[model samples]
Target: MTQWQTRRDDGRAGECAGGRGAASLSGGPSAATDAVLPRLILDHARDGIALLDIRGRVLWMNPALERMLGWPLDLMRGRNPAEFINLPENRPGPAELAKFRYLPGSSLFQQFRVTRHMRRDGTRFWNQQSHALIDTGRQDAQKMVVVTCRDITDQVRVQTALERMKDDLEHAAYHDDLTGLGNRKKLSQYLGSAPVRASIGTGRVGVLQLDLDKFKQINDTLGHAAGDAVLRHIARALGATAQQGDLVCRTGGDEFLLICCDVGSKAALMSRAKAILRASRAPLAWKDQTITPGISIGASLCRGTPPTPETCGGEALIAQADQALYAAKEEGRGRAFFYTPELGARYRAERQLARDLATAIEQGQFIVHLQPILHLRSGRVTGCEALLRWQHPTRGLLAPPEFLGAAAQAQLLPQIDYLAMNASLDALVSLRDQGFDDLCLSLNVSSAILADADYPALLNWAMQSRGLPPGCISIEILETSFMNRGAPDGCDAIARLRRLGARVALDDFGTGHAGLAHLSTVELDAIKLDRSMVGRLETDGRTRVIARAIIRLCRMLGMEVVAEGVETQAQIDILGRARCPLVQGYGVARPMPLAELPQWLLENKAFSLPVTLPPRDEPSPAAPPAGRARRRGDNSI
Candidate 1:
């Protein structure tokens, strides 16, 4: 009934304090001043203001309040506040209200909340509302509640958008974008969290580290897009194969980590590894190719008695898995292996050896030893194979088998290979200076070095600088070198060397699967029979027949046959009977340091054979010139 509670047709409140009920709102002796000041402040204020009874029935509203709700004062008066604003049903009780009472000698108490309010058009906006109890001073009337509202829709929207952006950034940081799998950071966080540690204390946790076997070959043979597709397919397969509680993560290129929290025993962990290995074998259809992926898995289990940091730490567990992975790859890829104490010990030793290798290269500790290759019929030293050795300060002289694996893993193969090549070429230069120009120095090279575009140039430079002829240098490559799909064709690399006038030989011929096939496709000067076949020559009659057949085959193919690891005269007789031209083994002579080679050749110059063989119809391939050979009484050095 108050004039201030009424609204005009323009949707605004009427004049303030124009009715008896409105005047009564000013309770003291300065009622007139109070009424005028309050009206001026409420009418000019930007925020919406409303007055309600104790029952939350709207009694009055300001012009701003009328505009904010889109409802006129006349329509809003005497109606519940909920009809216009979406207030929560549960209001503060008397005890809760007591905590909000602040000012002394006043009935004013405040409560603040954020809620949604609706307009006449049924649109909703975010509203920040403040409610306060006010003393009315009329004995018959209950205390009034003063409410103020602010439209915060824009602020709320900004805050909501910011929250969503933060969530998206967090998701991106923890996930691999290529596969949408958790990354190493996420895995680290999970493994290092307190809950995970506590769980490990109560039970066992298994970690599986997976590496794609020959993944580089895939990238080399196919394009990078194919490699990416394979990775995504593997990720999907892992996600589907993983148990509910397990976490699958892409640690880095072609490497994945899986954390299983429910591993009860070693058997359970092994079973999970087996399942992953099987899952990885499923072929992926990529473009026009059906790519069969292979993975090697290494598993480790961590069990803590009381959850010590050392026992359940992420690094230690991952290291164990990595060592097992190395072992799995060593044994041959596409399989799974569990971590053992021995593996850890070997891993530690290898790591230490890797560190020592860096020091060895720096200190000039690596040296070359020459093993003489003899002509079986003449019993004459013809050429020598350059073998790498490490003169460790504490471990004496270490052979290639003792440290080459560690060196390869440490990525020091290039440096070691270069060292061997330079040393061998220098020795060849020294031999030619001493009138042994026909003696060939065979230097072993890895596939990685052979595939390098710059390798031939490096070799040419080294030989030119040493004043050595390329014909006196023989580059020996392993059969496995030809099997690397990631590198250029072995025949191409060999041809490149041969174009430089250097002969190439396939070392360890009978040990590999494709040696016979390679002899046909690969243009080569010679083939070396593996030591395994040479070791079985006297005992295994089949080995002798195979050796004889290989020698005759190589002779017909315009190739030379060098029997390796020959240790006895009986073996030499068999090879001579087979017309094998070359023999090199411990029985002929042990590998001696470069400095000792001259004296050893001098002493062995008089060495004669016990048996003689029929002369060959054709000259042997890759044999040195007749002028390069020394007579029985000739002083070569």
Candidate 2:
């Protein structure tokens, strides 16, 4: 055996003496050994290689280490690795690792950790290191640790970019774009997660639903930008007023939802509701205008009661809160309501009705019924008001009040309005073909249609396509639509209809916020007295007085005054005495289908010679009939 000493390429002797290591080099147990080959391999290795004493002081470094760290081997040698290596904050440094107890003579290999190393220029690079202890096999030899490092900066950058992308996606998924609040996705996620339910397992949690009353008015009148500003302010107010651990979300247009965990009692929840109300009610300065949006809130609670099918999860709670919210709106806005079993039952019933309504529209179950409007003086059916009736597959005829709210809420009112308009137009053409050519059909238009600028053009096109004159169709809108200050476009729609030779009437007058002042500004062919005024005329002297005033004002404005809901002879007599020009109700004739109108006219002897109207002071394109009629009973149906 020939013992050989290990030496560097620089002719410096190394600590290790090779016996079989020298023999293994030549593939035989002989003295032919090449110690320079091992040093050359380490010096030229692609990976940065460093040899360190047990105390972690660098003994030698490869050329690759010098290039990777921007430090030459001469500058790196004899320096502690900790001086140049940077670990993340709170991680142990090389000195700490060296002090860590290890089994004596243990030779762990391929130990890996990613660390940041500072270059001589103070720039940092990420390095993935594999460290191991190499035994020198000499009696006075100190153990040398070999650390092999590869630059992993590009890999780390890719992983960091991926992480940032994931975070951005999470933020977009959870936040509402307009309000910057948590969105429906966040709400659903939080409710399904364990953290929210962990605090109150089958116990008390509260959900409060908030809606901005008449929020559409802001959007319609001031522009959507103002509405968006209002919504953002409302969201901020809700967030600020909410206590810790409360989840607030903007669930829909003009709607918000809050989930409160560990709610102690109804009173505690009420306090939160009040805070939100106050915050929202605080005047918001927008576009140089003070906008105080009214907020309606409804709350539902899941108490310690065991979870049932009805109270299973957050969705059920949300449904209950929605019911309460409807009640709050009904009870007048700017208040809060708590969920009750009765409200829940009613909500379910209404939901079912809404579902049925969608089907009814699709299946053409909705039929148009025309109630004859009689000229008060001549006792003649001049025109008919088109009333909506749902001819259910099982429930028989249903009135508008039964399903209109549901339709409005489900955003199906526009469809219903379209159907009704078509039915009315068809009926009008049918009536004209049946020797009722001169008759005018009064059809109710919804706010949704009036909001659309294109609706006027569509209506004109429909009438033109039918070869029917626009004068044959009269558009009627609720007084609330007229009273809407935000939607001047609705009035514009009315003007557009008038320009197309269609008569416009304000329906259900005296029920909404419009007053005599509104009559001065709102242009119309007629103003129909609301049923409330008509129904109470004989009983309530105040109603009689109001009706008389309304009729007088309308007449002076050259607008026809139609009295609605005149069910009794006395109501009719009183309206006649009040000089109301037109009246429509069960008293005149119940709302009959389009097919029954001619028969009803024949049976009730409702047709006199066609009455001619006097010229109005306002010079309307389609004025109401006030002219004297010639004696021609030959025009009978």
Candidate 1 per-residue lDDT over residues 151-215, each given as its tens digit: 99999999999999999999999999999999988997888787677657766778899999888
Q: Count the backbone clashes (under 3 Å) in each candidate.
A: 0, 4
Scored against the true structure, residue 71 in model 1 reaches a CA lDDT of 89
Candidate 2 whole-model C-alpha lDDT, 0 to 1: 0.77
Candidate 1 stretches with Cα past 4 Å from truth are: 1-37, 87-111, 139-141, 241-246, 303-307, 485-487, 612-637
| Reference-based lDDT, each prediction | 0.80, 0.77
- Which clashing pairs does model 1 show? none
TM-score of 1: 0.86
Q: Lowest summed-lDDT stretch of 10 residues in model 1? A: 628-637
Q: What lDDT score goes with residue 13 in model 2?
A: 52
| C-alpha positional error of residue 95 in candidate 1 after TM-score superposition, expressed in Å | 24
